[model samples]
Target: MTTKKIIQDFYKSEAFINVSEMEPYLHPEFILEWQSSKGFSKLDKQGVLDLTKELSASYVRSKIRILSLVQEKNQVAVRYSHFVKTVENPREEMLLAHFFVIWEVKDDKLYRGYQMSQIS
Candidate 1:
């Protein structure tokens, strides 16, 4: 899948809270990061999916703004802002963060994505 398609599917799933379709775009080792109420935190591949799946349970919306995306061969880097809110906390929080994600694809499926993120 192309980078644009990744963004597209993510947004599309945003509507239905169905991220399974996006699993293909993500590298198996994918890492998703965010700032906790205290400090920065990160999630590895399983962590990312687990978090997304859980959040989708309580959340009705998840938005991502791509600042930039550049991929050279297997590596993909993205800078973005994410807006999220959980069921317990009804207030939405917006985080402007930059991320560097390393990607490796196998069998035409995203195999791994090692990533890091921080507030911008």
Candidate 2:
């Protein structure tokens, strides 16, 4: 698959709500360097998996809206927003954050990512 397609699939996937299904989208040595409204954080593959598990437990469902995507070779840059239906009010979907991420695809899986987010 193309790098852009890989990223699109990952974001559109239910993996955020089902951690067990996320492994296939990430490389064994994946690393994510994230800068968010709160602060900076870094996570390895396992850490990301654990975090996703926590997110799955906290939210009833999650959705991603990709505003733009660009690809050059093995790298893909995407601008998107996350919306979630929290356990407390599963009937309402709230905008969680807007994100800009650049992902390096290696061996057909996401390897390295540089990400930034703004809380909504």
Candidate 3:
């Protein structure tokens, strides 16, 4: 698959709230450097999985709305918003955050990412 297609699939897969589903899209040595309203964090593949696990416990499902997507070679840049249905109120979907991320795909998996986000 193309790099852009891989990234689009990853976001639309609800992998953010389904930890097990995300593993296939991540490189073994994946790393994410993130800056958010809460602050900055650096996460390795395992760290990302752990965070997704926590998200899975809190959210029943998630949706990613892609505002913009651009690809150049093995890198993709995406601007999107995340919406989630909480475990407490699965009937209601709420905006979770807005993000801009640049991802490097290696071996057809997400290798490195630089991301910025704002809580909604």
List lDDT for all candidates, in order.
0.59, 0.93, 0.95
Higher-ranked by lDDT: 1 or 3: 3
Report the lDDT of model 2 for residue 48. Answer: 91
Which numbered prediction scores highest in lDDT against the true structure? Answer: 3
lDDT of 1: 0.59
Per-model TM-score on C-alpha atoms: 0.58, 0.97, 0.98
Q: In model 1, which regions exceed 4 Å deviation?
A: 1-4, 7-12, 15-19, 24-46, 88-93, 96-98
Which digits, one per residue and each the tens of the lDDT, describe model 1 over residues 26-106?
666655555544466666666666666776897656677767776777546666666666666758655535555555555
Better-scoring candidate (TM-score), 1 or 3: 3
| Model 3, span 42-115: residue lDDT tens | 99999999999999999998999999999999999999999999999999999999999999999999999999
Candidate 2: tens digits of C-alpha lDDT, residues 1-120: 888888888998988878777889989999999999999999999989998999988899999999999999999999999999999999999999999999999999999999999999
Worst 10 residues of 2 by lDDT: 14-23
Per-residue error (Å), model 2, residue 57 = 1.1
Runs off by more than 4 Å, candidate 2: none
